[model samples]
Target: MAPSDYPRAAIVTGADQGIGRATAIALARAGFDVGFTWHDSEAGAANTAAAITALGRRTASSWLDTTDLPSCAPVIEKLAANLGSLGVFVNNVGIGLNSSVVDTSYSDWQRILDTNLNGAFLCLQAAAKLLIAGGSGGRIVVVTSIHAHQPRFGFGAYCASKFGLDGLTKTLAVELSEHGITVNAVAPGEIATHLGPDETRHPHDIPRPGIPLGHAGTADEIAGVINFLASPAASYVTGASWEVDGGMAQMGAQASSHVANNDWRQATRKGTSNGD
Candidate 1:
């Protein structure tokens, strides 16, 4: 088949729910066949596959535990064989643990690091090899987090793993650009998803009160950024971390308070404030 006639294939890990699920559907809608992997949510994965099929696109689902590095190559091989070619690889598999450095156990730290950092590295390596062998320039988009840049009070392990991912993204971007592959990341903050609960209050989840957008973002919003990075439109963009937060990460404690005060003043001026 000619290059234009070849079917486009994309693999999205952790795609059973949240940002990953949204991205899989978006890519399918964009006319790319999808190969998605879920670690524990078989029903959710099947639902995602059905959604893609409903979009008139092909989809395949797999049970992929990202922490298993040795399984990466075989899974990629199987996905490539099933889809014809892999044009995009999304490293969306990650784990977050909320614990202070002193409270975090070694095993918990290792689990978070292995899943968030090592898994991403292994998947990227396997995908790069497959794309190079196929002789097709591919796109690799990693779903990093705002914690990759700014550390939270009780998420030491999570922050460390994401910081490592950020560094890996930049390194891979430099190394893979020569091969016509682009490497980039999307950093989302306070997104409402199964991965991040809205009701469960964590130190990181404390409403900044000063975010310019003034609300938590949705998983679809973050997925939109990831989808864009995987598309032809982002061909010239790489080695960057696009923040999809509602300006929460940009506000310092004092700045956030100031913004809240300003909002209060505006509300009072407009007689819309609830006087306590």
Candidate 2:
């Protein structure tokens, strides 16, 4: 069973693949009954579910397209209902499109914002309301990119959306504190996932001479931090952004993800998160 201090139920958005897939399985191993959403890949979602089930954890999934603002809350509610209740919510659904300031079309800009910013707002609001209604302390983790803090020339739309999320994380942290819900953000650097231009590549497939880690990170590396932030140990950690990059942030165009423990990858009984 999940620790009594926090709800064992968790919901992750865009969980069919990439970092989302890693986090869902991690939470399940940590004793969470996970609820996840898949946009385009039923096969990927099934693969994730198989892993969760193997851990002897209950899981539920739904189709979520963050660009549909009105659909966000209902989908969250449905997932929470399936899991019985919610304790931890991970808002990991977002899209990144490369467009320069001059090359950015109005339509593309809207598409990026609608998914990354506007859609995120609706989903986080819904999750927060559910946690508040439960009257028990909870956790909310947002998956942003390094763009949330630093700017890249070609990813204007993505950077703007992520920067907006950084503010949103702080705002929600303050607003939800009274309800015992801690909110934080995770900013990741180059990772091998389908999200980039070269889709479906392995972690070491792309070499990064600039990244201090010497290679791209895997989804599990970022998932490690997500798992920690949702644990009782991280109750006092809120309204902050943890970068999951491998020493990338040290450079002018770097990122951060600071979970130093490999133990986080495994499941074990955790202590009470006092909802500080």
Candidate 3:
């Protein structure tokens, strides 16, 4: 295919590692020239860019702290300009300050909201304007969490931010329909990444009781769903929040008890794997 016939460019934030890196690679494999942002992991981001370039796709990256709202527009503008077109915007940057309502200081709450919710909104706004100006339909995917639907203890601020992001997804979907822009969310449950303590990449060797699927998900799994949404197959789909968790949301509060009891782990002890 000619260059113009090739897939348009895409921007993925927080792509230094984990899900963000996976999504960037996946999009590149799907034929998009990828541009991504990183907060502190310049090396990780460089590796991700190298991987994409190795895939024969153009890639660009810069340091971007999502909480720095003032920088959103310029970053998007520069990336879109460098790539020549903007077709996909993945709002994958977020942080969860583990603290209860009482323990969560005002600064902590604001920090989480600023990065998780406000930053996403600002980036989305800038990307949407670019898409509209291009006069071509685009895709906007936000990476949320299962906590978005079912709250978790000590995650008040995180849950609230995700919930707000979901709401924004729907509202933007409605407004952007006329422009052929589809807005959606991917709510992942427990996905293992470099960010995890063990750095146990997903598809763990052992099952995890916290998730009904018996193990944490892989970043590639979530990236697959995101790639689908960014593809032509999802052209007609909008305003939807896909729970990419392995049935974690369905378990609700029982998730905690199951984790504590360890009874659910007995199945694995019986010499049977969860089959990933």
Candidate 4:
């Protein structure tokens, strides 16, 4: 295909693996020339680029430390230059912290916020400038988590960052709608990626009760939601967060399952029932 014949262009942060990789490939398959960023995994980034190119879409990969605001400008500039235009931006780069607030050091908190929240803002700003300059309007998708809506035991920092990102998505949607740019967030839950909890699980292992769907999600499933948002069909959609979490967000009934651990339970007619 001629260079000009390529559909639109997209940049996916953290595309070295997991949801970011899947999003990049999905966009490529949807006719977008894809660019992606990796932090410390050049091999993984190369693999993602190769996959996109295999789909007959142009691909560009760069090393990006999302925590460093100064490092973002060049990555965006280089990708936009190579892709010829910027039509979509996916804020998928983030680090998860599995620590309690009490145990999380100040540096750890800052690192999480810097990478997950501040970095996303910087990226959106850079991409928005290009999209506004191009005057074509564009899609901005932030890959949040189910924790954005609910807190978890060991994901304090992660949940906070995701919540912040969701707020950013809504605010940006309202602000950028006039310019025709759409801002939205995809909150995924229990996606079975290398970085996911299910990565080391046995195939026969039972699904977590927290997920009402009875199974973990896959990266491609989340990517499908993102792809739809990036498409023209979503032109009327903005300021929304699609919970691509397979009903996890709606499983308010799961709270009853936690009663199994309660020690204060009444005795049944025949015997003492400990609930569980």
Candidate 5:
């Protein structure tokens, strides 16, 4: 098949369910062959591959443990070999840890950081080498979280990892742009997924009543942003974190009110007073 006839190949991580699964399907429908990774979800990954095949696109699934870097390299190498070329890489594998900084154990923090930040770094490096070898421009989209920018009360480890990812994304965009590789990140807030409860009053759930849309966003919504970033339409966009939240991060007042109305402003004033 001609290059035009053959779909571009994309690799999506953590694609068994949620935003990652939706992104794989979206890319396949948009004329991309897909390879996705899932950990301990063979049935779900097979289902995703079946759906992609139904779209008349090629699909591959592999077991991936992001924290296990040595094991990850071979999976990506095999994906590139099978797919003929790797044109897009989506780093969607991540874990959330919610605990106060003092309560967060060293091991837990390391695990979250390893999976969320270090894992993505490895994948990006592998994908970059493959793309460079292919001599074709590539797209790298990272699935970060709104917590990358906004700090949540009890999610210290999660926030740190995501915040680090945001920095990585920006730096990669700058370094890779000369190679025709565009790197970007999407930060979603209060998405209804396995990471958090969808109900209004779950103890572990962050109440999103202050979101301008007044509802939890769907994984598909977040996937839409990833899809756009991977498409030709976003050719000029890079090094940016597109927030998929329903104005959650923009609502500083609401976030501050959870503690005290005046506390936020007072804190801000103190920072300003101290030349911060």
Candidate 6:
């Protein structure tokens, strides 16, 4: 291994595919033994493990259903045991909802909260305990959404959950700083992972003029930031949220998923359309 590479153990939740899978593999490449948890598809989790093994890194995986909040702690403990120790934990389990508050059912709201917030709390808490006991200091990266800081139409439940998670990220950062655990959040805008028939395609060639970058971000893009956060290079960074949008936050506009018009592509100044 290179002098910069540290042989450690890292765990990522919800690695069935997309950003979580990308993160798990990236950490393996960074010289960490990886343990990942997946939900929905066992095949996808196997694929992730296979990729990590192909990298010549140690890997283990287990199932994770974030809606079952009580199940989170045990899964974390099991993964930590399988990996030998925990130096990094990426809290990457989340589910989205597409309904306004008035249109949302109680069940849907509860499920979103249980999965995205309550379950996440349990998982992070469990991981933090293991890390603190290890006494080696660790990294905790939370995967939030651009909605964590902004609001979107028809996504009341999801937005609320992410907002709460963002707050949790900050709180954990401060609380865990003393234990040498750096806590951070990665907030992604619309990524191509869920956009097309080829769901795994990155930066799908779709016309999304609403974003300054003119396209959606990719899972790998988000994973790149996460990989950095989990590394020794980012040892001094903590309690910060990295917004990985394509300049959407600067425009203060909706994400690509909520934009249907190309009007946002142009700049408007004092009632006059501006910008080339």
Best by lDDT: 2
Candidate 6: tens digits of C-alpha lDDT, residues 1-276: 221333399999989788898899898898889999988678888999999999998888888787877789999999899878888999998887667688889998998888889999999999999989888788999999899998877778888989999999999999988878889999998766655475554465676677788888878889999999998889888999999989777765344466567764332212100000
Error of 6 at 276 (Å): 35
What TM-score against the true fold does each predicted structure earn? 0.85, 0.87, 0.88, 0.87, 0.86, 0.88
| Model 2 CA deviation exceeding 4 Å by range | 1-4, 195-206, 253-276
* Candidates' C-alpha lDDT: 0.78, 0.84, 0.83, 0.80, 0.80, 0.83
Better of 2 and 5 by TM-score: 2
Q: What residue pairs are clashing in model 3?
A: none
Worst 10 residues of 4 by lDDT: 267-276
| TM-score, model 4 to reference | 0.87
Quote the RMSD, in angstroms, for model 3: 6.4
- Per-residue lDDT value at 218 in model 6: 78
lDDT tens digits by residue: candidate 3, 1-276: 111322379999889888899999999998999998888577888999999999999999888877788997799889888888898999998887566698879998988888889988998999999988877788999898887888766788889999999999999999988888889999998876634376555476557765677887889999999999988788888999999989878885676555566443322211111001
Q: Write the per-residue lDDT of candidate 4 for residues 1-276, one digit (tens) a residue.
A: 121321399999888887898899999999999988887577888899899989999988888887787888678878988999998998888778667788889998998888888888888889888878887788899988888998877677778989999999999999888878889999987766653364576422647665667777878898999999998888888999998877877876756665466432322112110000
Q: Compose the digit string of candidate 5's lDDT tens values, residues 1-276.
A: 112321389999888887888999999998999998887567778889999999999988888887887777778878878887898999888887656788879998888888888877888888878877776688889889898998876678888989999999999999888778889999988776654354455323455566777777877888888989998888889999999888888788755456445433221111000000
Model 1, range 82-117, lDDT digits (tens) per residue?
887888998888877656698889998887887888
> Cα deviation in Å at residue 208, candidate 2?
1.3
The 10-residue segment with the lowest total lDDT in model 5: 267-276
Tell me the TM-score of model 3.
0.88
Native-vs-model 1 lDDT? Answer: 0.78
lDDT of 5: 0.80
